[model samples]
Target chain A: MTITLQEVLPTYFEESRRHQSEIWGKQLTFNKGEYIKIVAPSGSGKSSLTHFLYGLRNEYNGKLLYNGQDLHGYSVEDFARYRKDHVSIVFQDLRLFPEQSVRDNLELKRQLNPYHGPEKITEMAERLGIGSKLSVKSRICSYGEQQRVAIIRALLQPFDFLLLDEPFSHLDDNNSKKAMELMLEEAAARGAGILFADLERIDFFPWQRLYHL
Target chain B: MALSFQPIKPLLQTGTNAASRWFSYIGLGIGVLLLLCSIQMYINIQQLLGGDSPRKDGHDFISISKTITDETMGQLEKNLFTEADIKDLEGKPFVSGVSPLLANNFRFQLSGGSLVPFVTDFFVESLDDTFIDTVPPTFHWQEGDEVVPIIIASDFLEIYNVFAPSYGLPQISESTATNLGLQLICYYPDGNRATFRGRVVALSDRINSIIVPKTFLNWANQRFATTKELRASRLYVKTKDANSPDFLNYLTEKHYKVNKDKTKFGRVKQVLQGIFSGLGIFGLLVVILALMLFSFYLQLMIARSKDNLQLLLMLGYSPNWLSTNVARRFIPVYILVVLFAVAATQLMQWAFHHFAMYDREELTTWLHWSVFATAGFLIALSLFTNYRMVKRLLYRMA
Candidate 1:
């Protein structure tokens, strides 16, 4: 059950980056029923690469073959539709609206990319132990709480691949391990790939493959 | 320790920090002031345009005899007699009557005091019994009441200095008051003496006046008949159609001089109205200008605070999203400013009214709406300017 890149790329790519200069030499593929992790330092180009793959950066001058269809074949709008429908990102900084409550923040994301009913939010909140803190302001919450909120927000969306940028950097060892396990379990249930990057070397959870950039 | 080489984030926030704070204060101040001005202007315009309210409709038109010995009348004839002027006069709809007369302000002295009438008296062959009877001292009396004793203001009272040695200083107490019930003696050069006694029915203390009946006044004048003079120093006419063009045309064609009289009570009212309207409009203009200045300052402040906006962009939020977020935060500030302006204007108007300062009605109406409207306008303008500034700054940063 190999997940073809063409099948996943159109879900995230409004504009295909098959002919991007940066991804010209990189092999692009998504395998179903498997999780792939990309680890990189803070300043490394991992974020850039993710953007390139997601069709956010259109100036790449390389061949990115998503199941033999060049990434450049799609337009910018096509890539946005793909991102909206299939790709989700748990930002390193969490990218939460500080003015809004934690629950409202999650609600906004769910509305923007609702894969399931509101029941999914409850499930995610319970899994993250953020059920009680839903109405709290995101700014007032602990780093670990914010991290889980970010992850839950991304997990609630229906996507083939989840981009996690230092998703568990703020969590303690116990919470980090538990959050990572839950994330992997949720990804597996959805049959989605969890791609994450962090400054520290984290290795408690199991992964099918890891790449250092 | 090797410092990892990292590229700086491309987004940069621009502008000064104090811009918003400065603008906020300035904008609010201006908004409030302008709002007051607008209120005043509105009231002035209402008065000028003649609202249906009784006070607003108070005699704004003047009927002057064109034949008047006055600089004002002369100016009017010279500047306002063109065919175009006639059309303008017709359109303005002020009925004018003409009479060739010189208006004189006379200080009539009597035994008790001097009286300066607001409306000067010119002899009519037959004194309108109804009109004179309706006049005060007469109004104080009732039918079947005892023969109303009318007091006469003597030359002594008229010349009674406010700082006279005998009076020390004039006061409202009885010691300073002239004996209203007492009458000593009256005399003439003919050596005949008459005892005239009358109870003081009314005394206008402000003007130090003791008014008597026209009959007594005429009888007293017989001794001073040599000083009798006939000069039409005043031309008096009242008309329901005072603002009509035909009346003005009739006066003009008759070659009688007409001047709008400000000294007369009726004409003075019109003058006051004109002055009030002018002041109100001027005040409104000043307030509006102040509000605009404040709005400009407010935009500058908001532009400065946009540094956080760049950070949002790095999080993949677009320019439109950032603008919406900024606007949301700023809207509350403007609403607060508007509320403050309204409250402040009301307070100021109330203060003025309490002190009997400037015209209360005009001032109140101007302040109430002007402040709030100015505040609203400033907020909107500030937001618009802030939007453009943010857009331009972001484009540069991008």
Candidate 2:
């Protein structure tokens, strides 16, 4: 499964902004099993790009294609099937059910399209240092803990591509390294690609292909 | 309760206005109860009409005659039933058969012998044997039979018995009267007369005229002077229901008269059936209104959870799958409500049969199979409509 972007630009962005943007109005292809980095400044539509790629928004110029099929033409069932089996995403804002327990949040994802067992969730939580917070409600947990929870939730489903919109922003370097290591192991096991969009480059990880915006 | 649906359960639930749920269940219960009751009552009415009327004669036989008014007095020709009139009356849907009474146009007399010496003027008529309550096999006759068979009205016998005691005459029993023979004398206007022996063959509680066999009447009328026209002054109509408004209305519209006492039961049955039919329609309306109310409740619940639903859809829950889960959640409640209504209808039927109707042999103590089938139909309709409504609402969000 490959995603192709043909001269894509967010419709909300001005023509002047597109001229200064490297990723906009450019034909790009992100293939399966490739770790790609998209680095851009603030107010450069980083989240908009993630939302467009996740199929949450479609109001943009040019085309966003999934395996050569235009995104605009995707039916509702097609989007759900792709989300469950082809792609998964970790939103920048960590959209978790705040009142639900951390364990329940992961259980929901696992049961939707189970690619992992409950023990796998427990094993991941232990490695991320949130094993003790599994019974706690997501809202009462700290922001960094919720971010790790969100990352684990996204990884619970089977996917050929994973979209992370600055997933490690709230984490310290050590926790970020553990989370990234776990994500890479999971992605490598399935031969899935990871698209990490962030503000700047991280020293610990080197990019296979980097898009500077 | 399937684990597959648990992922969207929290987001799709809204529990504040719980009164709507109760109201819908209650309304559905009442609506279904009324519907079933209406059907049972209709069935019961049919059973009563078809059972207890005691129509030993096997059909309602009504004799109809044109009402003679002051203007029609002494105008026998105008009052007689013409061929067109008979054809029109025969064409009525309620009239199963028409048998015109053929009256003797010449003079006839009956003279009793030494046992009960009495003489009376007679006007004999003949009807088709199918309409008579009692027809002996020997009632038919040819040209030269020594004796003719006659059937007198049972009312006429009773009237004679009432007057016989005052006249110092014998009050005869049915068997004694049937064995006696009398002389039937027919006189033509040309001053020639012929006599034949007549025997009592059968008695009729239905037809009022003294009836002889059709063969005998035709032979005697040929020998005696009579008009060529075979018009009927009175006709007996066979009907399915004597008191049906359609039949009675037809009689009234044609200015024909019938005995009202015989139709009193029919009037009561008609009024009862009408009431039950009205109740059935009202019950159907209530069922529709209740379903509509439940639909509104479902809409409100889905609307309250709008934001959460959208988020769940974004989480890869298909609208169809989610709507199916939501609709399935109410299946047990719907089943319970319909079953409760059916049980209630059965109880009402049992009570009506045992207590109100005093265990009438015709009525059953349980609800009809159609009532249960209707309950099943209601459950299916509720599920399907709720499924469609939920699917439509979720599709809008999608």
Candidate 3:
């Protein structure tokens, strides 16, 4: 699937802010099975960009096209289906249910499809170095561990595109590398694309294209 | 990715311990209690107004007589109800049947054998068999039958019990009175006398006079009366509704005297019916209010759990699925409440039957089938309403 953004400007940004930016009010397209990095400074609407693509926030100008169809035209149920079947996101805040155990959070995503199983969750958790923390409540886990859990949760579902809004901000280099390696392995196996957002570019993977905001 | 997770239990347990929900439960319990109590009380009052008589013939049969006055007493023939009067009463819209009470012209002497051999003259009045309340299977008597079935007024026993002790006579029980044998001798005007054994078959509160089978009375009157035709003094009018204003007005306009005791009973039944109807309306209002309160509580809970629900929705769970998870939590509570309410009502009914019921023999059970039907209706209504409310809230949130 291809997501095309035509002159997209968040409603929260002031008119002067849009004029000060190059990414806003510009036509851009993220294609399938392509690794792209959205590099931006702090307060440049990276999270807003990710939220718009994930169908979470709709208060933005411009027409977002998913495979040539207007994203605004999709009903709530249609958007839900699109999110479940095509787009997966690891939010900057890592919206994991605090009261649920880490395993439950992962299982909530994994159980949406028949191919993903508990063994896969365990394997991913072990690789992410939070295997032992899987049974602990997400509220009690460290921010880095919770971020790994959220990454594993997002990867559990089948998606055509993975949206990473500073997904490894709390993780150290090694943990971030491990998380990125696992994400690449899963995305490669499913022939999926990745949209990674960060303040600065890191030499984690060879990006086919990079955009600066 | 297979969505094989059983999120229902965990989701339900997450918000299961809301203390405010107890208010809804208590409200429901109170509503159910009021409804069940009203049902029970209505049934009890019905049994009470019906009295000890198992048959409901009293409502259909009205005893009417010509209004007695000094002028009519001086004119003896005017006191007796003519054939025209009977026809006029029978022509009324509410009147289904009309039967006149026939008095036996022959003199009958009743002697209690051996126990108390005091002889007394007794008058026998007979009406149509349809008007009699409790007719025994052996009430019919043939000419050759040795025993004659007699039904005595229940008030006669009450009066006898009141005065017999003062006169140093034994106050007999119903069974003893029924078993007591009496030798009946009929004295004809031509000096011919015939003897028959008499036994009390039943007791009647509706009929004021000593009653014999109409067939037996007809035969006895034919065999012993001096004249072929005898005018009736009292009439039994069967009406659809004894408490109808038109019937009462007609009775008043015609200057007919109705049995004050039975009419008072009819009035009491009407008043009791009104009371029960009012209680039923109140109970319904309480149940409706309780339902609204419960729905409001459910809405509040769903709102409180909005974040969890939205997270679930983001995970591809349909609003309907999440709504069902929320609704399932209340299913067990509702079932238990209904079960407990019905059980409590049944217990109350049991206590009423064993201790509170006046005529235990008349009503076999205190728990009427309507109670279960009403409970079932309530359960269905509450569950359906709750389910719908939960779904509506979830859909609105979606």
Candidate 4:
């Protein structure tokens, strides 16, 4: 029953799994510093599986385990606490409040971890190349700029794992590559595992392991 | 396994989900309107009741009265005015004028046997001539016998059915105008006859009634002394001193009465009391229902906005923050609704003033304060409901 990261690799999937097919996995695991990439076609249930893992959708008939315990043991408050203190998600739509500023977006993330200082917002803004644009409203920024801010916001929060769902969707090749590099560097510094969902774009940075849904 | 009433989240993705959202807005609107109306009603009632409840004017020294027929005298004793007392108080500025005397409808069965009833109000007099001034000899006494001049009511011509210049009656000619006489065949239920020879001089249009020389009344009484019956109702009065409480007291002690027309006051009071009491009740009902509906809408909106709230909740915002934020959003709407209600009430009062000829004070006072207070109550209700809804939602979610 011991969960390991290697067994969750996409290349190790069975042939019975087809596109739009439902699959169940038990005893799933990720090492503290692992970099895992999951790829599928447009309708291959990659987002669905990601939502399941993030605790956003829980109707599926399967067991989700963490640290050798069933996921049901975690209540909504527990999930919220985990999202605030040990996990963060970068949504596919770059779901930022349009009325807020880039700095505030990141600051909101920092607030999730009560111990995080305000200086982290400035540091993250500089790293995301949005330091000058921090005061700018989110809607006013270009897609690439917004993408960077979203990633930076996700990073500002205290977390041991990052779930990125098509975080590079709107970016051009060069910006996407740069954003991927920055994301990896931030996650690696914190020794957090990064589970990224992507289409068949084939342009993502090399990952330590890949899961095909 | 213990079950929870969790939201069916999967159903929300469809467009049909928007129906509930629109419904929530409608509920909110109704609730707000109810609260506003209730507040308006309460204020109006307070204003009408003279700041608390209904009240009537207390009796005072200058108690005016009216005297009806002797047959109805017992019934009118509680409200009677004496003739001499009325005449004595004629000149007082504070003594508002007595109302014009109401007369019985008189029918003149003409010589042609046509029955015609004419409405008449004539000033009566005794033979004393105390209140009458003699016309100068140059004023041309139109007479044939004793030359007793009689100033007739203008409407006397209408009752006689004799158009002097147009009817072509011989005795009413221009040369004999000074000596024209009226032989009125006065008939009661029994057969009757009367010859009244008097010179008709001037026409009067003073008030809603007609005036006559006091002598003419005496002439009628003397001419039919054995047959004519007379009744005196009231003597129109003006007081020499309006603030003469002593005079009023003296009149009271003498078993005499003074009556001032307070119909205007009574009418104004009744109309105002009626309108404002209804408005207060309506507004109160609206607020109560509105509070309920508003609270319901707030709860529903909280449920609808659950995901957004959850995001914030996950972002380490305290439950109190969500409550404050939700309550703050409704503050402006509540304020606007209340203001609209108050403004509407004032506008309605203004309209009443513009159209109503009677009393504007009653309408104005009720609307001005009623709307304001109601609006305040609605605003507070909205805030309170919003806070409670958000708090409950947060507790449930937790």
Candidate 5:
């Protein structure tokens, strides 16, 4: 799967800001099994760019093509199918259901694709140092724990591309490194690509290509 | 890897407000009950007005007489109806048929051991056999037959009961009076005498005089009368509709007196039917309003659950799928409401049958097919309306 952007400019962003960014009014293509990093300063529409790619935001100028098909022509059901089978996202806000436990949060997405099971979730939770918190409600968990839970939930479904929007903002350096390694291993095993957005680059993970948003 | 992929249960309970749901159910149930009862009452009134078992004379026939005045009272023979009067009555558009009543002129004495052992004069009147109700096969007399079959007026029994106590005579029951045989002695004006046995065959509330068979009257009147020409004092007029304005107006214009007691009673029945029909319509209106209120309540609940529904949609569930989940919650309530409403109607019908109309044999059932059909129609309408409302709300949210 590949996503191609041609001179894409979000409608909400000021036109003057486009001159400062390399991605604005520039053609970019993301291919399968490639890790790309979007590095930008604060207030640079990193979340907007992720939402646009995930079909959540459409108020943008220029055309977005998904595997040679125009994104604008896709119906709601088509978008839903795309999200279920091809693309997965870890939202910046980590939209976890407050009433459900971490396991329930992870199980909700896992139910859509049955390739992964509870043992995989437990192994990932143990590796992330949040195994004991899986049975507890997501609302009572710490921000870092919730972020880790969201990461596990996003990875539960089969996807060609994983979109991450400042997913490691609440984590410490050591935990972020651990989470990155876990994500890299999963993506490598599935032969999927990763689009990570952040304010700064981390030295531990190497990216095949870097774009300034 | 044993990942448990259970879809999360909804956080907000969609059981609905029990009190409000039940309140709506009760309101609807009462509406249904009122509708059923009104239909039952309307049927009962219809039976009373038109049923053949209770009314001795059908609504089609009416007995009429000329109005008595001082001049006509002084000359009673002048008031007697001739063949011209019968022909005139039959010529009217409303009058289907007319039969003149015949009266016995000879004196007759009735002597029975059990009751009425008097030797006074008794008068007998007769009309066409078709005008009488419940005519026995033996009412016709052969040449050798001496027993006479008579039909006495039911009001005559009431009058006799009222006067018997004062006259120091025993008041007899209907069964005993029917069984008592009386010997009749006819005294002719020429001093000839004859004897015959008499038996009461039937009783009638419509006919106000003693009724004998037309065959016997013609046979007896031929042998005993001084003249051959027969003049009737009363005539039974069969009209298409007794309450028709034209018939009443014609009777009034001719100064003829008709028995309007049955027609008046029929009018009262029609008024009852109108009132019950109005009440039934009111009940149906209440049911419609209650259903609207219930639909509004469901819309509110769906609105309250909008966030969760949208979240489910975002998780790749179709809007129709979510709507089905919401609709499933109310299906039981809908079934229960219909069942309860129908059950309450049936219970009311049972109570009416065993209690309210216990003595009325003509009213056999309070539950009519129309009642069930109406209730079924209302239930289906409510369920369909509710389902459509839910689907519309879900689609809008989507």
Candidate 6:
């Protein structure tokens, strides 16, 4: 499966901002099982592209196609099916139910489309060094701990592509490297691709092509 | 990964007032009870009145006559019913039999035993045998018969008993009156006199008249030849449904008068039924108001959890699944409330049958099938309404 962006420009951007951006008017495609990096400056719609690909934001000028069908036209049931099986996303805001524990947050998504057993939640938590914090509420957790929790919540499902918007923003270098290794290993096991958008280049991630936004 | 509503449950229940919802449940319970009780009371009243068993000893006989207004008062013949008028009444759907009341045309006087000698001028009439409540074998007369058997109205007998002492006369029992012999004298236009022996045979609750055999009255009217002719002024109408609104309204429209006592009681029954139906409608209004109140709580809950719901949707939680779970939470509650109403109705009916009605065969202790059908209808209605509301609220948030 491949996602194609056709001369896409956000509705909120100024005309001068569109001319200076490389991805605003260009047609680009990202294939399955391939790692692609987009280096976007501040206020450059890096999060907007992630939201648009996840079928969340529609305030854009041009079409986004997933497997040749317009992503904007996907019905609710179609989105549920594709989001369960085709694509997954982790927002930069780390949208976790604050009152719920780490185990509950992971179980919620896994229950929707279960590709793993109940034990996989504990296994993934332990591997990310948050297994002892499983019973703790996500709200009281530190920023770095919440970001890792969100990463596991997104990876609990089967997908052809995972959209990460500055996933390592709150993590230190060592933790960021650990979380990145887990994401890439999980992505490689299922032949799924990763579209990682961040403000700067990370030397650890092996990318096939780098687009400047 | 068990299917659990644990995560979304707390999110949905926030910001909702519990007391308001409890008040709604009470209102809903009262509404359902009123509706069911109204139906049961209707059936109970129907049993008490003539609605349950249509026949009482015999068919219902309604006495009808044209209203005697001032313009037609002195004109006796004009006020009497014509044959066409009788035919029109007989053709009505509610009427099964019609008999014109025949009266003795000649002047008549009856004198009973000589002790107090109950003597007075009296009028004699005859109606069809079918409409009479009680008919003895001896209540028959033929041409040239010296003995005449009569049927007297029981109400008239009671009235005479009440007033008999004032006139220095004795009050007679029903059996005594039946045995007492009497003299019936008739005078022709030329003042020639003829006499016959009269005896009472039966007392009737059906008609209020001094009833003789049709053969005797017709023959006497022809022999006496006192006035121009004898015209029937009233009729005995046999009907299946004496309390039918259509039949009564028809009589009113045509200026036909019926016995006031029977219709007075019928009017009372109608008023009671109207009250029950009105109360039922009022209860339904309360139920609807409660449902709307509960919907406000639902809106508050969803509105409070609007961000959580949007995030859940963002995580690929289908709106259909979320709505189903939300509605499922309340469907059982509605069913239990309706069942509570049904149980209350059943208890009331049992008490009515056991205490008020003395365990009569007229009413059943349990609820009627129609009551359960109403309960079922209410459940389905609540289900549809809840499902629709949840769907609309979720879709709006989306």
Q: Of the pair 1 and 6, which is ahead by DockQ?
A: 6
lDDT of 1 by residue, A1-213 (tens): 232333222223333333432222345565655566676666555556566565555454445554355657854334545555566777766767665678766665565446667777777787768888888988899888988988887776677777777777788888787778877877777787766666656777566777665
Encode model 4's per-residue lDDT on B1-398: one tens digit a residue.
21111222221123335455445445445544544444444444334433111111221212233434466667643344445444555544545344323222222221311122222223323222222223323233222334335333334444443653354432232323334443333333344644333343433221212233444444445444553434334343333332234444455465554443322333344566566566656646655665665566556666666665666664445566556655675666666656665565555555545665245454453455544565666567667866877777785775
Chain A TM-score values, per prediction: 0.77, 0.97, 0.96, 0.82, 0.97, 0.97
The alpha-carbon RMSD values of the candidates against the true structure, listed in the order shown, are 15.3, 3.7, 9.3, 18.6, 9.8, 5.3
Query: Model 3 over residues B117-170: C-alpha lDDT tens digits?
Result: 567788888888778777788788887778989888888878878987786777
Q: What order do candidates take by TM-score, descending?
A: 2, 6, 3, 5, 1, 4
Residue pairs in collision within model 3: A111-B2, A111-B3, A112-B1, A112-B2, A112-B3, A113-B1, A113-B2, A113-B3, A114-B1, A114-B2
DockQ of each: 0.04, 0.48, 0.34, 0.12, 0.21, 0.45
**Lowest lDDT 10-mer window, candidate 5 chain B?**
B1-10
- Taking the tens digit of each residue's C-alpha lDDT, what string does model 4 give over A1-213? 222322221333444453333233433466667877778778666776676666666555546665565555676666666667776788777777665677766666665564346786777667657789989988899887898888877876666778888888887777677778877877877877888888854456667877666
* lDDT tens digits by residue: candidate 1, B1-398: 21111111112222454565556455555545554544554454444333221111233223233354456555644523344433433443343322212211222222323221112222211122222212353423332344335432343344544434464534333333434443423345454554444454433321113444545544445543334542332233333343333454566675545443322333433455557556656655554565455445545544544544443443334455445554455567666766666667666556655565455454343354444565677567756766766565554443
The number of the candidate with the highest lDDT is 2
lDDT of each: 0.51, 0.86, 0.80, 0.53, 0.77, 0.85
Please identify model 2 stretches exceeding 4 Å from their true place: A4-30, A39-53, A57-75, A199-207, A211-213, B6-12, B52-59, B65-95, B111-116, B144-146, B177-194, B218-226, B241-256
Summing lDDT over every window of 10 consecutive residues in candidate 4 chain A, give the lowest-scoring window. A1-10
Which candidate has the top score in DockQ? 2
- lDDT for B236 in candidate 5 is 87
Candidate 5, B1-398: lDDT as tens digits: 43221253464344557666667777777777777778877777776665322333344777888888876895756678877878888999988888888888666565664467556567788888777766777777756788888888888888888988887888888877666577766667787888788888878766788877887777777877776677788998776567654676688898887776746755566678789999989988878877877776777677766776666556555555555556666667666766677677777767776788784777665467777787778777777777777777766654
Top-TM-score candidate index: 2
What's the best-to-worst order under lDDT? 2, 6, 3, 5, 4, 1
TM-scores for every predicted model: 0.42, 0.86, 0.65, 0.42, 0.61, 0.78
Error of 2 at A19 (Å): 7.6
Model 5 pairs whose backbones collide: A117-B2, A117-B3, A118-B2, A118-B3, A119-B2
Ranking by DockQ: 2, 6, 3, 5, 4, 1
Q: How far is candidate 1 from the true structure (C-alpha RMSD, Å)?
A: 15.3
**To one decimal, what is the Cα RMSD in angstroms of model 5 from the true structure?**
9.8
